[model samples]
Target: MRYRHILAACVCVTLATAWHSKATDDIAELPPMGELSRAIGPMVETMLNGGVAVGLAIEDVSGAGMYSHRADEPFVLASNTKLFTTAAAAVSLPPDYRWRTEARWEDGSLWIIGHGDATFHIIDGYSYPDHFLDQVAEALEARRIDAVDQLVIDARYFDAAYQHPDWPRNQLRRRYSAPVSGLPYARGLVRIRRGRSSVYSTTGDPIATVTNFLVRGLRKRGVKVERARRAGIREVQPPEFTSICRHECPWPLEKVLRETNAESDNYLAEHLFKTLGAEFHGRGSFDGAAEAVRVALDAAGASLDGFTQLDGSGLARAENGGNRASAATVTSLLRAMSKHPRGGPFLRSLAISGRRGTLAHRLDKGPMTGAIHAKTGWIRGSLALSGYMRRDEDRVVVFSILVNYNAPHTYDRRQVVLSFQEELLRAVWDHLDAVDTGWEPPPPALVQALEPGRPAN
Candidate 1:
């Protein structure tokens, strides 16, 4: 009976959402770019010849232009998945929605629930919230609560699957690609500053150091919580005396999203993926998040029939433990995100070429510099890039390009294949100006390079 009731409630919710989606369907019309396609055809062929399966999408924000090729296919999005996670958060959570790192007073004791916010510590000038424990204590004192008896921590929001099976075990040692956690703090990492004590030493000694704001805050609060501990514990353990009273909470949503996108943090992606369901569906299960994404895709009229998803973060997957999404579905989601009320925030969070985020190193000093804001993804042999591209005449273009099977087996061959795919995209962008005029005669060097039977660089 309860199941039936839940089903009925879901149906009603779906209908209401469907009507809402239908109301927003009248986006601006897209313009045609046939000449642009022909110009980019050879370049794409070259990538195919080099053994890459590619998916690409280009749509003008003004509703004046659009194009797609294999945009419907499923390719591992890698960190590009963070775009969806962040967008979903903006839609589900309030624009100013804050993930509270709460300090609770129970029986004259203080308990804190770790809500995963990655930027709660100082690294390279970015510091955790100053005097966080003092603020919590101040809030408590304002309420006339005199003291805390003990400390209790609740991190039951997410499950025990700290690491996904699809990920390489060695990745756990790295900060950028640490395993996901429900109550992650300080980016779920500790920086190890290594130096040589003496040049004559026979071996290099490395020291691992941690910057735990939560511990520091608790100590200041007259509460004694140990510093630089591992992620989880089976039972609560407080200090012998209640002499300390400081604790640390996570960072703000905007700052968290910025770090996740700019650095392409893998753990952040996983945590955000699970957070979608926790916020909306009342659960943090990966399946719940997958269902939310599926429902959204269905409402958008995109098909996701054949792909297999192993994990929300694209981490390693069990036989059927993960959920799947495609380039087409992602593009549609991006379009919807663009139309969302807080879409501007999501768009700006992406890395811009030659300026900030992952794109800072690539496309530097290129025409696309400062014109492209996108997320990037990479795995053993796959590469995916998708987001909004600022184009000629102030046009905003949405695009997704995935390059899979770049090399049959060899590593160098794979790099060449990936480079070919990038060239294809560059060519497509270059040909847009040709739309207002006929194709220009090929210059001598250009003619030879693009001649029939000529090899693609």
Candidate 2:
């Protein structure tokens, strides 16, 4: 059954109503941005005080546009870049695009070709397809193929830049840090579910195992487990494990995208990013994927102006270098996407704070609790939010806020900063005819960070 999250619907409505009053068209443009800044100066002051280096850009999709503060400057977009990736995929591929993971038998050997299907896994002895190995076994038995052979795995689609140098080294083994693959299964996760145990050991120990059971399940299909791991390319052997057939996957592409977007799964994001690269460029290297995304954006009529991309996944790696996106560019892309055929579904897939997916609990009791449907990105000191805001009369507004160099205090880093952001959004929500320019003093934490911290490199 499709997961119909109710909160998603409610939040969409709130945002739609919030911006309904103002002319969506540019004809009724508000006073100059300087005027708008003065109107909301108090809230902006609060954000700056809390040590948040923020850049926000909000627009009326229908008519006149107005912005306040640094809307033209570039800021680290973080995972908000996923919007570009998703938009590219939606436009380039047919609605039913499906990544193919294959197994081939030749001579006495078996070959697995990974087309970057990130969810390959078996849990508690149950493989993802549940019947995947059965298909392999059936094919082997039908051909009277049995005996021994080596398993050949191909990972040539992606280069060896597995870990990003800028990320904390300790995070490499995390699921979010899973390596991008031409054929990824289970997001390359070695599931490590742990629980308190009655075992005599005082310390809680983790029980970790690789799901998808690709190699192990193959052994069950009459193929001898001769070195049951990925080795060199083009493995060869005499006819041992014969008769291989393909089985349809359990999850479809839309289903996969829904889950990935809802929970902000980085592994899936990277896999999909590389998959697009491989599909379009014939290679899944980071550079290839990056190039493919740029090409896709250009094709979509997005200005490639002032855009730099080092990695498709945006995993904060040194190799990815760092890229920035101006508020204007982000909103322009959102506006374009909303007009696209699949825009509705794509927008609906993001998490709504205190409502669905990864954001179900955040801002649960706040003013905009059920009104913000956004993609949130956080890595160390960076925080970003981008998505559609639905106000009165079904008015739709798209906004992006990128905050870096968070303050050191608890309130500054958390509540105060979020409060300032929400306040700005509230003004947009109410469509207060014109912005309030009186600036609010920043939170103490933010004030300290801004004054004491070194300039961001």
Candidate 3:
């Protein structure tokens, strides 16, 4: 009996030793956070010299940390808010989701229902199948309905609010801040071109604008109107209508996301926000959309602490405590997005560094060029960048850098902030792999090359 007990004890000891060895190997595989902190500490201090509140976080693909500095503190995110909005959208909305517009003939009138197709206008580079209204007219012609007693616009898929209350009033006329409507035609803007100059204008009544444009389009396509004065925008019951034809937005949801993130298109972002509300909560109001976004984030397993999202476009600053997010939150979001089933489309939609979108002018010429895919955000007193950095095919790093300032928004200040951002990125990239096996800290000469005094190559 004593010999049998001894053999059993030996077996248990061997198993315990194997488990201990595996744990040690796992620890050794993690990045050297201590050394990374030492390397990036000085660069961060220099960059934050005059900046008010700055937050930064860099972690490996699995949320394992390489370095973190005040990453838990929240800072104004500006357009970086699009990252959250778009990611949630990608998960909630399918890849094939398309904005649809439909026409129906009911009670001697032609009723057109708009589903918030933001791309109903002639976007320069994109190919839309004929004009949307023209397609409707063609369908009418095919049915031999040359004349109609009246035209009704059913635009109630979204709430009646034309613009968000938090948006800047003065910028309302600009295309970026154009009023959003359930029925957006030409992205809710009218262009007036005189001589060699062209000016853009926004309408307080989007329904009226769409109605007028449709009247002209129908007339041009040989559809007659018996009483043009009877046309107006209103909500209609779906059961009372007989569907005639449907027109889909030219681009898919993924392409729309690409435009939103790459160009920082505020209009598209807000439209998508309301669309999410319409999809989940059965209401397209801002409140409903905000709630839907919150729910989606929670479902995606994202940490919501220290984050406040007021508007999808990030145009609205948080009131007592405005739109704010921590570097850790943003980095974790990136990590989560990467693991999502739709993560590929979401990540591919981001602006590639120095290649396209808003980043075309940034990180243009460097070893880091094309190595980062991120979103850039800038508003008065705030600047932020968050995304993934690919050191190679095997190593991916997620990072977020947010800076807030009290200085006036001026050209010089903008330049200073941009320079600091560039330098900081360069420093991170230079020392990223230094602690890896067989690698040493970056040499002094290489470190000096990233100084702000040295003009970019």
> 123-205, model 2: which lDDT tens digit per residue?
45767643766776677777777653766665556644554455467777665676666555554544344585322211111
Question: Please, what are the lDDT tens digits per residue for candidate 3 over residues 141-253?
Answer: 78777888888777787888877777777877877777677777878888789899999888778888888987877887788876543233353354677788888888899
User: What's the C-alpha lDDT at position 254 in model 1?
Assistant: 64
**Against the hidden true structure, what lDDT does model 2 obtain?**
0.58
Global lDDT of model 3: 0.74
Rank all candidate structures by their lDDT, best first, as comma-separated numbers. 3, 2, 1
Best by TM-score: 3
Error of 1 at 307 (Å): 6.3
> Number of backbone collisions per candidate, in order?
29, 49, 2
User: Which ten-residue region of model 3 has the weakest summed lDDT?
Assistant: 446-455
TM-score for predicted model 2 compared with the true structure = 0.75
lDDT of 1: 0.54
Q: Using alpha carbons, what is the TM-score of model 1?
A: 0.69
Q: How does residue 368 of candidate 1 score in lDDT?
A: 65
Measured over all alpha carbons after superposition, the RMSD of each candidate to the real structure, in angstroms, is 15.1, 12.6, 15.2
Top-lDDT structure, candidate number? 3
